[model samples]
Target: MLGAALVAKKASELGLQVKPWVKTSLAPGSGVVTKYLLKSGLQKYFDQQGDLDETVASAIAENDIVAAAVLSGNRNFEGRVHPLTRANYLASPPLVVAYALAGTVDIDFDKEPIGTGKDGKSVVQSSVLPDMFKSTYESITKGNPTWNELSVPDSKLYSWDPNSTYIHDPPYFKGMTMDPPGAKRVKDAYCLLNFGDSITTDHISPAGSIHKDSPAANTFLSVGWIRKDFNSYGSRRGNDEVMARGTFANIRIVNKLLNGEVGPKTVHIPTGEKLYVFDAATRYKADGHDTIVLAGAEYGSGSSRDWAAKGPMLLGVKAVIAKSFERIHRSNLVGMGIVPLCFKAGEDADTLGLTGHERYTIDLPSSISEIKPGQDVTVTTDNGKSFTCTVRFDTEVELEYFNHGGILHYVIRNLSKQ
Candidate 1:
């Protein structure tokens, strides 16, 4: 209303009218915004400029629970609005208004009469909103919006399916810790993946088609899946095991461990064997070993993927050393109880002469809770070489999250306190 009123006010002051070529609609975040306009008599300003409310109208009996809702805002795709609804529809504001006016999907809007007026053309008490809608907005004072009168969804929480494969309860909620675990170290950790610059979360955990010869594919095959039934990894992300196997499995990713191999290949330095990334990590775990990841500049630089960090944590990766990090992935790494480290100024993998075979030991302060952003850390190699690097923790809270074995445990601990 404000925008339209401004344009209308300018046109009227200049003794001109708005061109019909322009079109406009009001779709505020809250319905109470309409009440503000109406109470302030701003509704008339819009009307004077030929701007109708064009509000979507619908009738509902008592105790109606919305099974699904499609809005005019950006982001409308299959299973985008609600997972359980099974179907969703996207429409423009004007189309929403028309649908609400029609009120019934069974009646074709093009062929059926919407309704008859009171004078044989309509009996719009049900359609025009007899009292509740008008007075609700009118009850507020003009130009003085109040939160007490804002319309909100009656329900308290979003209903979720516990059995859903796409989105289920995140494991972080299972075991939470308010008082996180104490300070820890990255002990005898081998490098899980070694990559060049610009490794995105997608490269870390791809949701696209699982490759035929990929570890994920082999896992599926082991479970009796045919070649035709091997779906995308993204669809199975809710399951940690599948996603963990899919991590670092992007076909486009080139692991430096394989000396220019363009896939999830990695060398098991202890066993002196070449294997898939997931297989190597599993073998390392069975042998009671932890792992770390190594990357060049701008590591994890795309698409704030939670799984980029989550997958590595699940794969027994205890730390990540990179030249730099994209903001969210770094936080994600910390949130998952994995250490994020950065090389000292003017030092990186090549400069440090990291050959992807050296054993790594990350030293920590006595008190993990006191670890702050940009704190110094000592990364010592198996050959008795040590170098100082900056720990990438942004706050004591993040370190606390790490100590709690990721933020989920921290959240659970806090909730238990309440």
Candidate 2:
């Protein structure tokens, strides 16, 4: 915090300011911290950078040009910050100010000036107290007016509002059964998506802004919600209808099925129709056909977002066949009852001579008890091509979870027996 104050002081003295293109703002931890900064006579300097509400209101418009975000926070993963910020960097608070002033990360403070001086010439140059803390701590337990004003119902069992678009009961266990359904193979499955290397969870999951015409946004609009009122996929996660329609909906996804075109689109194998990934998956489900994803190495590499797994399961993805898988996401796929398979070493879709336009069949054991972790499974394509994949169960517990259709079903059935 002191670093930010010093930067502000130095920038003011040099007549340098944050770039207008760069969105500048401060989200301090609490009002008390702001109060202390105010008491220290540094708030005025901070205000010069426009630390207000509007700058952080919503994500910037999507563009082909690369955008970046430098933050003092630790979670600087790919899509965690904002959809438009393709690259995220971690820096000290003062360094954040430096980058913000420069409006770009491509600079060296040792030789380059952060910004041009007031005369439009390039230049190169490079907090808390404890006293009022007691009073702030006294009221910390009581939330602010908005939080306190929330009307929570008083009941043992929570009432689910059927009309709510924000929060609704998920359908994971809607038709669950106590008895296991014994293992079955995925036969005649269509390739829903064909992806290449480094396909992160960000690419697989629904995230960031809800596009104006996205399926999630349409679902909201159908129920009387306006475009601006449709919060992000992260906010509407409680509603399965919205999330299921958003699977594989990343704006930047590159499906090989589209032949180098970007965005969340795929070829519906049966009809040769180019549809959104979710729309293709829905049509496959309606036609009583299971679907599988084909991908290259390091698939599911980014954040271990549960929605990445949950959304695929809801989309009727029976299996995912890739050259390799990220450890946590592999486990998550099993927990959601979607089989994760890896191609044999040195073999991928490119080498196996298989295009994504083939009908696939995964030959699994007849019963759950016969399946073992890391066992070799045979996958065949309709074009007379076949390959071997390593089943990614990894443990007996995971096998049981898949046997019961998902981890939630496994837990619920066990609890009922008790």
Candidate 3:
């Protein structure tokens, strides 16, 4: 709610009209925060006359883009993205509204454009973002304000109960036996990869249209969902059953050397047979064999969607040996109990001559304390080819998330218990 109000306030101040779709009830903190900000003269530039929905609808009608500024942890507006929006840039709320009003990502601070205000005045876009952030931060952190005083009630905010049955629980291993030392080694090592550049999260977990005639569409159809019922991949994230099937379903993917088989890359070991990406994954999982994914630089870029990591977890990918990783995806990988190992300096998927044929083993323990960032882990294939890669757990927070099995699990165990 604070985020919404901030966007509304920013839009009004910039003379850009807003029409908000009030999806959830506004919380007391939102009203309190907004009213306090307004009383403190932070929102004085924004006009206070319009209704939220009307402003949002008007803005959407008038503008070419409809972007959402959502927090990563909040699930309230999870399924809000529609087919109409051209580009959905997800970031913190202030950034979303600022980017929307500016109408472009390439905003030049030195020569910013000015929008005409309703009061027959010129308003500069440059002043909108920085000022709002500064004031909002100060009001929320330093100023002690009540929700009722600000006209925001608790009933207006969306409520997310951590105990909700819809959320998946972390995997439990109450009576499982641990693998004995040296028993986890694999003989054949095949590097399943492609020579590519700039593999963003959109490529990993596409947010665009899913054609019903495609391989992924056929899989969905096989599972009883009709073409029209096939929603965007982003909408079906909560269900791992659907996510695993849909991961790597992006049509733009081209496994150049894999006999032109696109989408997810598939490789057969020993017999040297080939199959669809997901089918191969299912085969490996069925045989109780571990798998790894090798890729070029910037392997996971774009939106901070957690499903990118979760999809690989469901597919039985033990690790992603990438030349580089985007910030959020790296954390998301660890959150899902997957190892994200980076190639040694000046070495990559291409240099190693990985043929995606070797069986691989990751010695990650189910326990968190046993793993440390920057530790060298050995990788050996069936043909006796071996290499040691450095493990990275860059932050303590990431380690904690990994230790607890993921963010959702951590939240449920900590906050929900209270």
Candidate 4:
């Protein structure tokens, strides 16, 4: 993944000092990326930028700096990138080099120069894509389709172990409805999560190893799945029991509902008790209080993780009110029938004094047919205050899908009619 490690390297080469506060990390999707990074001479630059050296607390003796992670991979969501790093940017190898030199993304590449040339004139050099052997890439994929030609099991009715940890038949569709256009207002939803900018899909759909003490782990533990077989959330995705519990289970998320407490936590307002995020969600569902997420700019700003939306949907989150949203995340939310709302400029939960204790009511059109792009929706807070927001649905297709409570549900209804 295009990550902090690479950007740090670029910064080092240009004599730019990455602010020690900027949390940096290198989380490539695979080791092959590392091989090419070394082959392309980019790894040395990463090493130069931020050494696996001093801690932020240690670097505090020097300067209070913000950590910025640059990665080639696409997963740059909030807590998923790393707990310490607040800003994560996805960039090409060349842009990483430029940002490393510039030490920020707040630059006008067209108007501002990155660095000076040795000759004393403006150095306008852009990095070229490194060359790779076509044959090398071709050889790797040569036998992929040939392998798929292997025979399938004879029986159409596949056998299920029922107790398999890696796979399970999800019960989501067991009692599923195939209705159309059930759009409804988000009424009195609780703010399950409140955070600053750049919340990624990784933070939403955590793929890392399941924690032994997490709600997901507890379910497996209760089910007799030993800690050793408790495989990752990614591995247990087929099981709704695991995935539903695993939702919001990211250990790195610093949910404000927990008063700066780290890892899956929230405050169940009715009970005035703090609990793990999943447990809190269960309580809220039992209490019949719908949930909402309040966030700063770029909510859902990392990888296009679908579970980020699905997890919250399962948790009964009816809406997400954010200053802004990463495009793909906004779409994914709608694809799951979750209302994505944007705060009016200069407004957020903090500015309104919403301490995640306030009840929320969202006003929208009664049906998808009446809604239009960039439509205004009213949000009323508990203090008898109200503000208007723009609906985040950017397309008719998204609106239609959302009305039916998600793309799959919409497809099911349409197909049933056909």
Best by TM-score: 2
Weakest lDDT window of 10 consecutive positions for candidate 4 = 120-129
Task: Score residue 392 of candidate 3 by CA lDDT.
Answer: 65
Q: Report the candidate with higher TM-score, 3 versus 4.
A: 4
Model 3, 48-166: lDDT tens digits are 33323546645654663344433323332212233223343456554444454554556763577334323211122322345565666677655565653555447864453454322
RMSD of each: 15.8, 5.3, 11.1, 8.3
Candidates in descending TM-score order = 2, 4, 1, 3
Give a tens-digit lDDT track for model 2, residues 252-307.
Answer: 68898899987778999888999988888989999899999999999998789999
> Per-model C-alpha lDDT, please?
0.67, 0.82, 0.56, 0.71
* Clash statistics: count for each candidate: 9, 2, 28, 24
Order the candidates by lDDT, highest first: 2, 4, 1, 3
> Which is the leading candidate under lDDT?
2
In angstroms, give how far residue 196 of model 2 lies from its true place: 1.2
TM-score to true structure, per model: 0.60, 0.85, 0.54, 0.66
lDDT by residue (tens digit), candidate 1, 123-234: 2222234354676667545544566566667789655566554555555555433466676777888887887888877678656566678887787788787967766676
Model 3 steric clash total? 28
lDDT of 4 by residue, 1-418 (tens): 2333344444465777644444344455544566566664556656633332346534532453445666666566543344344467887755665665565678887898654423211111111123333434556765667687966788887665687766777544556776664688778887787876766677778576677688888887887778778767777777766787877777567677788876677788778787887898888889888888888888887667888888888888989989999998899899888999898899887887777788889988776688887899888977787888888889888888877878888887888888
Clashing pairs in 1: 116-121, 116-122, 117-121, 117-122, 118-122, 176-409, 177-409, 178-413, 207-234
Candidate 2 is scored at a TM of 0.85
Q: Candidate 4 overall Cα lDDT vs. reference? A: 0.71
